[model samples]
Target: MYQGYLKYKTVIAELDSAIQLRINIVLFLASVYLVLQTSVGFKNPTYGGAPKRLPEKINCSASNRGFI
Candidate 1:
């Protein structure tokens, strides 16, 4: 009975360690993804630009009006 209990404890300890390692890995991946997303967003202007297409004349007018 004592030996069985010891085996069970060892298994539980291993499972706990594995779970902690997995959680750490997931958090690291999430942090990496967030950093990559932020870098991409800042480097790519289209990510924050208008979604609709504007006419060239309107763009020129806006530029002339100092709204650009």
Candidate 2:
């Protein structure tokens, strides 16, 4: 408010505090989402499946090929 700003510096300080609170809220939500995803992401079937393989474990021979 123009009246508040002209009278004292408290108005600007209050606005700055409100802005910081909003920013802190956003950051907290983002951090919570990141932690949740990181924890749940490991439980996904794609991650737990046997797709994680080494080149040596694969059988690339003709007999092992399917409809190739």
Candidate with maximal TM-score = 1
Residue 21, model 2: Cα distance from true site in angstroms: 0.6
Assess candidate 1 and give its TM-score to the true structure. Answer: 0.60
**Residue 26 displacement in candidate 2 (angstroms):** 0.7
Tens digits of lDDT, candidate 2, 1-68: 88876767787788999999999999999998777766566577353333555567777788789846
Q: lDDT for every model?
A: 0.78, 0.74
At residue 42, give the lDDT of candidate 2: 57
Q: Which pairs clash in model 1?
A: none
TM-score of each: 0.60, 0.55
RMSD of 1: 8.1
| Residue 19 lDDT (model 2) | 100
Each prediction's RMSD to truth? 8.1, 5.2
